[model samples]
Target: MVFKKFTNGCVNLVNKYLPDAFLFAIVLTIIVFLAGMGITQQTPMAMVKHWGTGFWSLLSFSMQMVLVLVLGTAMAKAPVFERLLTAIAMSAKTPGRAVVITAVVATVACWLNWGFGLIIGVLIAKEMAKRVKGVDYRLLIATGYAGMIVWHGGISGSIPLQIASGSAESLAQQTAGALTAQVPTSETIFAPFNLIICLLFLIFLPLVAHAMMPTKENTVTVDPRIFEEPPAPPAHKFTPAENFERNRVMWIITLALGYIYIVYNLVTTNFNLGLNIVNMIFLFVGLTLHGNLRRYIDALMASASTAGGIILQFPFYAGIMGMMTGVSAATGTSLAQVISNAFVSIATPVTFPLFTYLSAGIVNLFVPSGGGQWAVQGPIMMPAGVALGVKPAVTAMGIAWGDAWTNMIQPFWALPALGIAGLSARDIMGYCVIVLIMGGIITSAVFLLFGGMGWF
Candidate 1:
């Protein structure tokens, strides 16, 4: 009875505050502990090693975050860019339509860079909300962020994964060689398809939400103050040199890229240094680029503050991966058998992609990071696809589709979106839920059709 009471109290407290963090900690701890106990195939020490791996992984995560903040801030302050984004968000009048536009814009930005995508989408949604009255701003914000989920599936997303996979230099060379192989590039074709699908989504989503809007015609009161806030002043207010120096975040990303360039060239040239040593050098450079000793102290604190949730969850995720990998290694075809059995049971070939899409969507709930999810799921799915006679790229695309569509409703990405828009999930839930459901259905259908026809 005492134990039950303690558990209930803990649950209630967690439900009220830090729900995501609490859930991550609990799930990860249970998984890691079980793996450690040898209840799963993995030994505890393997899990420990995985946790140690996070020390390096977290640095990459930090680099991505810093890049996101700098790009976001740049987009937010750029007048021409801001106007273009706002126009995109406001293109569709209905809340659902607005969300589709937001998602497309976000996805495109994410394709270029995930961090920039989040910043631009959130900023645009916020601006649109300020201009329009009675619209659900939260939904728009969620829609904008949804685009970020698929970034890892795009061409640019391949780079970091290649690096982590220990194939970065080779992949970079291969990509460069393939650059001139196509007229417009594969990404160009995919971009238009994505845009068209988003347009279709915007058109249909409003009809779905029409039932939810207030029925009676009421006086539309437009706030004059909405129009009164002048546009952001010129960039001259902050000089170019000051902009570069003040935003240490940008410099970190630049340095990281430089490090990547050096590593790529060195590896291709058959240089001797290990990948670990290269990463260490980059970490040192990241630390040194901050300049002032005091600033480094503050940055350490700031980084910890921002990464608290991520750090807390790392052990558990690592544990889960350890257990899963162990199972795969021991059972030989066990994982493949399970997936193949699932695939065989599906009625049609189209159903296979649909299943892949839905499976990816479910995974996104727990693993929100696109690159991370790919790291975890990619290997499993690749062999599973071979066993099931599905193309690996098609399965990969399905994973991407699933990752992108669910970002609409997931609170992980929504926090930044909400922060920028001054809205809550509750405020946006009504509209975002509709977009999510619709987009998920549409995206799944697209994947299924493409996979079945071998169009991907």
Candidate 2:
């Protein structure tokens, strides 16, 4: 009873103060520590390996934090681009149209990077909300939160691509070729198709939702003044000539592209310059470009400050992943047998993806990290998929679709969006429930169709 009370108290405290990532970390740590204690008595070597894996996983996450911060800061400071985005968002005619536009914008933002997508999606939704009247806060929240779903399908998602290509290393090997083939293909095909589908759903969804709840009215209005004030031209701190002389943006872009090129080359060529050496190069370039030595010190400190939460949380996630992986490995065959048995009971081919989707959704509630879930589920599903004569990629897509669709209602990723928009998850769940249902159907159908065509 006392332990239960203590746990509950901790949960309430975390819910009040920390972000979901941090909260997840805290809970994960407690669970891992207890589990480790139990397992160490029987398998010390396995326990050691798990801890080691957790440590490396934490380091990888820290590196990801550094990358996210750099990209986020640069994007935020690019006033010209930000204003352009705002103008485009404000151009939508109705509140419903604005919501649809927000979804498309969110999808595009996620294509760049998940962190950028989440941040910018919130900003766009907030901008739209301010201009729109009688707007359902739920609708705004839905639009903002839906951005997370698109992240897995986006160009930079890495999760699905990693699974599709076998692993991160393999994906990196054919980076240039894959970039040439996949990027353009994604742009020409999936991107426009996704946009049109989202728009169509947006148009039809409210009508269906209205039918279900007949008493509720579609009550969203737009203010003319919101669109009347054209944004002032960006203040160029440097004149055109001065800007040309400074060349800060150009330098940054060049450095970024150079880093990507080097990384791609090293991976593709199977060269071993060492990841640490590459990181050092990035650190040196970032420090030098941000400013002189003194300013570099300031930048590092600022970056470190923002990275603290992520740094702490990542290890806990690693530990949880370690535990999950350990469990799966120990009972993998038995689990696979059970899943296979269940599969036999299902009636149709559609049942396979549907089952995987539902399982993914359930697991996502507990393990919101896409990479972590993939690590746990990939091995289990891949073998089953092979045995069943289903392409592994199709199974992977099923996982991704399920993971993405439920993110609409999951508070894990919603916290940041909520903070930025100044709304609770509850405020959003009302409308998002509709989107979730529609998205689920659409995603399942897409997977099934692609699976049949071997496109997945």
The C-alpha RMSD of each candidate to the native structure, in angstroms, is: 10.7, 10.0
lDDT of 2 by residue, 1-456 (tens): 453344234334543654445664566555554555453332556655665575556567556545554444333324454476568766866666666667767756665456667767766776676655555444655665666666666544545455334444553333311221222324322444344444544455444332322112534333535424246468667677655645656556656676777777668844333334334444545544554333344444543444444455556556555544443345333222233235434624445666666666655654567776665555555455555665444555556656677776566566555544545555555455556766777766655665466543
| Pairs that collide, model 1 | none
Q: After superposition, which runs of candidate 2 have C-alpha atoms over 4 Å from their true positions?
A: 1-56, 62-70, 111-116, 130-138, 157-160, 163-312, 328-350, 412-434, 445-456
- Distance from true location, Cα of 337 in model 2, Å: 9.9
Separately for all candidates shown, the number of backbone clashes (residues 3 or more apart, or on different chains) is: 0, 0
Whole-model lDDT per candidate: 0.50, 0.53
Name the best candidate (by TM-score). 2
- Weakest 10 consecutive residues, lDDT, candidate 2? 176-185
Candidate 2: clashing pairs of residues: none
lDDT of 1 by residue, 1-456 (tens): 453344234333433554353364466446544644453344566555544554344455544444344334433443455576567656767554554555566666665655556667777666656655665544456556656655554444542333333343543343332211222223322444444554555455434433333322321223426433355356667677655666767656756776787778668845423333333443444445445333344444433333334344444444444333333334343222234335436625456657766766665654555665555455555455556676444555666666666766555555545544545444454455556767877776666666567665
Cα distance off (Å), candidate 1, residue 25: 6.0
Give the candidate number with the greatest lDDT: 2
Which runs of model 1 end up more than 4 angstroms from their true locations?
Answer: 1-56, 78-104, 107-113, 149-351, 422-432, 450-456
